[model samples]
Target: MEEMLNNMREEDIKEARLMLDAAVAFRGAMSSAMRREIMKRFCELAGLPFDEPPTIVRRNPFEDENLRNNLQKFISEWCEVDEIATCTCHELYDSFSDWCMCNGLTPPTKNVVGGALRQMKMFVSYKSDATRKWRGVRIKEGEER
Candidate 1:
């Protein structure tokens, strides 16, 4: 496992991030219409049928910002989402959870809260873990504080 991890390339890291971002961790109360729009956007991004092999192979890492912007628009256009009311607290939590799992992080930090607190905690947990991992790598370098 260590050798496998050591062999992972920069492209692998980039692909992982792109894949995670492309995944819709939280779609605020989407309806069939909204889902259709999302599918359309996905198809356009992929430039192939939805049934294509490797259901998620068309992600464009360079188009992250554009895709994010479009995602927000689609979410708003299809659903009467309330940034306050309709936005569930666990939404962020779910995102964090998904990111953690997607990144192969161990012992996922579970968000027990059902509201905003949960989201905040999940974000903090992921950030904290990321920070610790960065620090560990830096320390291993023996060239930085």
Candidate 2:
């Protein structure tokens, strides 16, 4: 596959460059309608597929009131007041789930909780000693302490 990919004709490369330039110009158009039309016209001229792929709009977990409430409860219950700025959320999911189960509440999935934590405007990450790890801190009155 690599060997086959390496053997590209100069004409094909030039054509791809021209298409990219057209796409860039189309992106710079002031009107969104005009841009789309230009893109469709360019595709027609280049003999390329003009069909726009279906857009996937994923629901944000943080946007859910129940999940946000659970997160707040978990933070207040489990997180230390002083260490809130340096607390890690990845480990909190298991306990949060357990708490929800015991309380007969809808238990949120770890992935959803993680995503919610990451997206919430109230939570911010701080650089920690661990190279790939970030500590989640809840913002107080929209201010970072």
| The best candidate in terms of lDDT | 2
lDDT of each: 0.37, 0.60
Which pairs clash inside model 1? Answer: none
Which tens-of-lDDT digit does each residue in 14-79 have in candidate 2? Answer: 554565577676676546666566667555545567887567799777689888887788667655
Q: For each candidate, give its TM-score against the true structure.
A: 0.19, 0.42
The alpha-carbon deviation from the true structure for residue 85 of candidate 2, after best TM-score superposition, in angstroms, is 4.8
